[model samples]
Target chain A: MTDNEQRMARAGDYVLGLMSEEERDRAEHDMERDAAFRDAVLTAAQHFHKLDLTTAPEPVPDQLWQKVSERIASLPQMQAAETAPASPSKPRVAANARPKRFGLHSLGGRGGFAIAASLAAACAIGYFGALATVTNPQPVVVVVLDTPANTPGAIFEAFADDSVRIVPLEEFTVPAGQTMQVWTLYDKAVGPVSLGTIGAKATEVRLQGPHLPLPKPEQLYEITLEPSPGSPTGKPTGPILVKGFARQPARS
Target chain B: MDATSDDDLCTALLVRVARGDRASLGELFAREAGRLIAVARRILRRSDLAEEAVQDAFVAVWQRASTYDGARGSARAWLTTIVRNRALNMLRDGARLDYVDDDMLEHFGERSADAEAAYAALPDREALKQCLGQLDASRRRSILLAYVVGFTHGEIAADLKAPVGTVKAWIRRGMIALQECLS
Candidate 1:
């Protein structure tokens, strides 16, 4: 078969759910890189999707929505514009921007407060080391922050005492009069609080953050570009260079 | 509402969902969950498993809503793709299926029937229906069983009483021809 025909056939296999797990993964990866392949897959998916719509709607269990709501109550939506890559070389981010608010308020629920309290108990055990009493030695949560381009930008290890060890994964070129400011949203009510600010040159620096509730899983951490020292306003004012949700390290 | 308007509403709701609007997500769920469950049930066969698939798909939708591009496809199609993939993954996990048993054989028969029923039910106006109808019966059945019910090549071979290699080729050629016709 011709290359275009082969691509179309593979796209058909992917849309039909016929590919093996490994093949599916590769096709998805290819879709990210190849616009033609992605278009083919999308077209095929749209074409076959009519079959899915034809199925008669079943009676959903009354509690199903409740269950879904509870599960997503603490989850935050990734902002399309904020996650958009600054450069044109990266994959295009969605152009639509409806809700423009930033920080914890964007999360739209108080359920995260309950999760934070529970996470503190887990943090007390200190999975990384036996010495739990060693004055904030272990990180409560490790966040691998990624650029809007989805490349690793930085790694943040937040401690119980709120001191975060920042490791820059990429050499972010902070403009002549600009600095990279770190921020986190621990609660919707409090909004995003500034963690610290780094200079023009990126480096590994530990910042002592304000004493707050213990860091929890899925907490938002981000770095934004602001004028000289920092944002004239306390909140992140400029474009987000990188951002990610905190995840707890696996228990050893 | 007609399908196009419903699709437009879904797209609008999804845009709101991408912005962290939980209420819109709920609205989308209330609107689409029943239909999604039905679609998933075809592949999963069990009501509870189908519900699980829909649940997972919603959570994924919440997380990845920002990635949804309208230029790529309709919101309904995107949602369908997510649920279908989830259900397919659950089936491929193989933990739920008891192999080679009489019960499984019965399920296989039911699955094949469901696949054909889906194709037979397709609207005559749909180009997909015309293209799929034109394929050889074995090829068409093989593609349908795989797409509609998440059947693997080996399962299709078993269902059609044909060799797995021949079934795979039939599907590959069938898909090429189908795409060519549809295009």
Candidate 2:
């Protein structure tokens, strides 16, 4: 065979699955880099698929269709599936088991000033200068807490200063005499650590300085409904109201 | 053979699927599922693997329906390519054909007159049949074995009782000839 014939034959082999795994990988890489080779491969694939025209159509088992439908229905978000290609999407591990909805809202006007003053005072008295300047130097990791159903609930911003700021995006009602407590879990395998308590009517709570040495990504930030003082066990004793993972801003 | 109404119908269903219409996906499955499973069965040579391939292909169809370009190829051809690739991946994963009886493989190769009629009825495929028929018997069967059953050159050589190099030459020449005839 001529050189052109040999090249086309290799392309044909790739389309027909005659190449070994390594050969196939090299050929696929070539197809991606070389337009001519890609065209040849697509052409070969189009031509070879004609063979199926003559093959008799077989019956699909009834149960197989059910399995496929059930699987598609179970996807967490069908919105992503609409535009996704044939190849699987990037697999991601949520710090928690659920997907989160994030909405960033700034604290503004008079309420913002009072809260900032109280936060600065809280930082000066409780944390000392060691933790105060920590956030000023490093990146702040923010966590947006949402329900499993993808409703926006709250936001947790972790500063390098070892302080975590929690803002409730949605209203929460604690039972009579009960308080809402915030917690953080760097690892799901380990249990949560209490950050501080917040009033039922409070719109935001900035934990002055928690025991976290540094704010890390994928740390779970959650709010649980607890007794007035807090969980006696030093762990979350009530049901979790909202939760999410800390994330760094996507780099440009 | 060029852009028939059936092709248009498949493309329409795919567009609906891209818009998140579950009913359209069901319609596409209803129309094409049997043939897709049959193609998968030929390559995988086992019912269980073929079923898995078909399920995966439909899931892909759901995920990739938006990527379908009608100007590029027929919708059936596009969907068939996805099924074939899925089945071939299973075959390449060291899924042997040993579980299937010999007659099953022969059944895949067998074509009744009605099947030939059905092939001729498909848009553009009749041209394919005419081109394929023009090849030598050995060349035609070698190409068919590779395309339909996902056979390697060595497997085709073993099946045809010919040397591997000779089988390779036939398929190469056969493909070149088909490309010329179809064009």
Candidate 2 per-residue lDDT over residues A1-252, each given as its tens digit: 776666677777766667665676566546434566666666666665666665566887878778878888876556576667764222221233211211110243334333433342332211010111101212357899996567879987765334566778888878987888888887666678777777676576566444343556687888888888777887899888888988865421
DockQ of 1: 0.25
Best model per lDDT: 1
What lDDT tens digits, residue by residue, belong to model 1 across residues A1-252?
899889987987877777875676566556545778877776777788888977999999999988888777655433454465753321111222122222322343333322322232232210111111111134667999999999999999876434677889998877788988889999999899987787777878777666555687899999999997788998989999999999866532
Calculate DockQ per candidate and list them: 0.25, 0.16
Measured against the true chain A, the candidates' chain A TM-scores are 0.47, 0.44
Over 4 Å off, model 1: A76-252, B99-102
Q: What CA root-mean-square deviation does each model show from the true structure?
A: 16.6, 20.9
Off by more than 4 A, model 2: A1-3, A79-252, B1-3, B95-125
Report the interface RMSD that candidate 2 achieves against the true structure, in angstroms: 20.0
Candidate with top DockQ is 1
Give candidate 1's error at residue A170 in angstroms.
51
Docking class of 1: acceptable
* Candidate 1 structure lDDT: 0.74
